[model samples]
Target chain A: MLSTKEIKQSIRSISSIKQITRAMEMVAASRLKKVESRVLASRAYTERMQQVLSHLASSIPSERSHPLFTQKESVPVIKIVLITADKGLCGAYNNNIIQTTAKFIKENTGNTIKLIHIGKKGNLYFSKGGYTIEKYYPENVEKFGYNQVKTLASQLIDGYEAGEFGQLHIFFTKFKTTMQYSPTSIRLLPIEKDAIKTKVIAKGEYIFEPSAEQIIEHLFPKYIETQIYQCILESLTSEYAARRVAMIAATENAGEMIDELTRSYNKARQETITKELLEVISGAEALIKG
Target chain B: MAKTFKIEVITPEKVVYDDTVQSITAEGTEGSFGVLADHASMIAELQTGILTISDVNNKTVRFALDGGFVEILANNVIVLTDTCTKEGEVDVEKAMAEKASAEKALLKVGSGVEKEKAKAALKRANTLLKLANK
Candidate 1:
């Protein structure tokens, strides 16, 4: 049984913790709203880009191949771009992505695996584990813009062209809903042949300005850039959603603890008062008898 | 009333414009071109320049576009760009400041990708200023 003073102290501490978590929950909710809009807007752009690229891919003769579509039989190394959150208070968000990457690396034991980390948490975990970190962008995840994504896309394209790695995979959390996000990995380089193949063939012959080859050549890099940008936006949205949920849970737990502590504190105070009253009454009776 | 076609100007951030327009004139990498309703299906690479759009009411709306691509099919025109700012949306002083900074950067950077980027930035700034002043 805790003394009333101890219980009271605990209730005060817990109530303060509840206030902090409540503040965190509200902050996460507002950030989530802002990021959600960005994610939805970018989604429209990505969908249009995919539609155009697929149309081009299907229309172009098979013999006309782009360097980006070249798939190697086997290569010595594989690169993984792992995206995680910068901060850790977000439930299992970072852990899930890290685990997914680890599983991928484990499964690809025959090839040398290197990592490119986008967020600090991934970088910190992988760097300490003796993995070869190809690159790490230390920029804050919340501030990510098109420029940063462009630089990253160009680097990845250059490395792929230079044959630095046979295959490039990106691991990110796909935002399905506010309550659900799952870590997903997709092969980014040497884009799979079937991925861009469209079911609907061209209804008629189309004119290509500056040549079809030039247009396809220009569109492929933009395709990669848009894909990467969409992934980053989705991951950021998921991060905020996860943080909000985690903070809400923390706040609720704190509330429960305060409630329990207050109950115990009241019980302890009542017990002490009853004991003191009994002592006083018994002493008075003894005096009366004497 | 002029026959109109649907035109959508989209950037990565959002859809800037989506409405039925009488016609549109855009700068293609090959050269400037105009499209009316029932234009042939075509795909053209775009350059940094002013995009002139005439809506159903024959009202002209201009946008300063950073480099991207334009696709036309049937009666629909899709203009995709990295950034698109309407004439009314362009900030003249900011465009001037950007132009000055881009010129400085163009002078400082040697021959390579950096120079190309600075040149593009300068071109975009110039286009924005051109549209705004017009």
Candidate 2:
């Protein structure tokens, strides 16, 4: 059993920890609100873009393919873009994404793998594991804007055009709800026709400005850029959500610890007082008898 | 009141414009074109230029659009672009600086891809300058 002094010390430390965790929870909640709104606003643009792409895909003949949509079977190297949070207080958020990416790499042993890390945590883990890291955009996850997405998209497209890799895939956490997020992998390159194709075929025949091919050529890059932007936004939102939940749990645990410690402290103090009282009564009885 | 159709100018960050307008005139890749109410459903690739919109009251609003696509379906016109700035929102000093830097980059870049990118930047800067001056 701990003495009252030791128990009191633990209680003080735990209450301070609770204070910090409570503050963190509030911060995460506010940040989550901002990111959630951003994610919702960007959904409209991505949905509209998907609709236009599907319309264009249906109009163009299957035989005619754009450079972005061309599959290169000869190249054996696979490029994986892994997105994770820079900071790691969030429970299992970064670990889950890194594990998913590692599993992907392990499953595809036949082909050589190259990684492009979007966050510091992923880059650090992969680099320590002796994997080949082609690019590392550390700290960009926190402050990614349209220009950053554009530059990243252009780099990926240029690398693909140069035959640096056969296929390009991105791994990110999809934000389903504040309480739920899952690691999702999307094949970005070679423009999966079936994935973008909509069930509701566009109503009427449409006119293209220069040609269907030319419009698709322009639209494909924009499509890729938009997809990357949307994924980053979703991942950011999920990170905030995860952090909020983790902090809330931490705060609750701290509260429980503080309560238990306070009880033990009181019990130890009461035991000491009872023992002193018994000694005092015995001393009085001994004196009286003497 | 004139017959108006819905137009929404959207970027990745947010929806820039969403309202019913009488007509919209924008610069397509090929040439400048105007779309009135009940126009045919068409998709046009836009270049960096001024986008003019006329309201029901005949008041015109101009925006500098930096390269995007415009889709017309039913009575809805969707302008999906990288960036859109209204006439008064264009910053003159920033546009001038961008124009100068883009010109410098265009002169320095030798590869085809770099040249194309620099050209696009120059065009965007020019459009913004024009809008700001107007």
Please give, for residues A1-290, the per-residue lDDT of candidate 2 as tens digits: 99888898889899999999899989999999999998988888987897787667665656875666678868988999888999988989999999999999999888899998898999989998679999888666978777888888888899888998899899999998999999999888876567543433355666889787889878977888889888898899999999999999999999999888888888899999999999999999999999
Tell me the spans in candidate 1 whose CA falls farther than 4 Å from its real position.
A124-132, A143-145, A192-199, B1-5, B37-40, B96-122
DockQ of 1: 0.56
Total backbone collisions for each predicted model: 0, 0
On a 0 to 100 scale, what is the lDDT of residue A2 in model 2?
Answer: 90
What's chain A's TM-score in each predicted model? 0.93, 0.94
DockQ for each model: 0.56, 0.47
Candidate lDDT values, in order: 0.87, 0.87
**Model 2: DockQ score:** 0.47
lDDT of 1 at A279: 100
Q: On residues A194-278, what C-alpha lDDT tens digit does candidate 1 reach at each position? A: 5543433455656888888899778888988889888888999999999999999999999998888888888899999999999
**True lDDT of residue A270, candidate 1:** 91
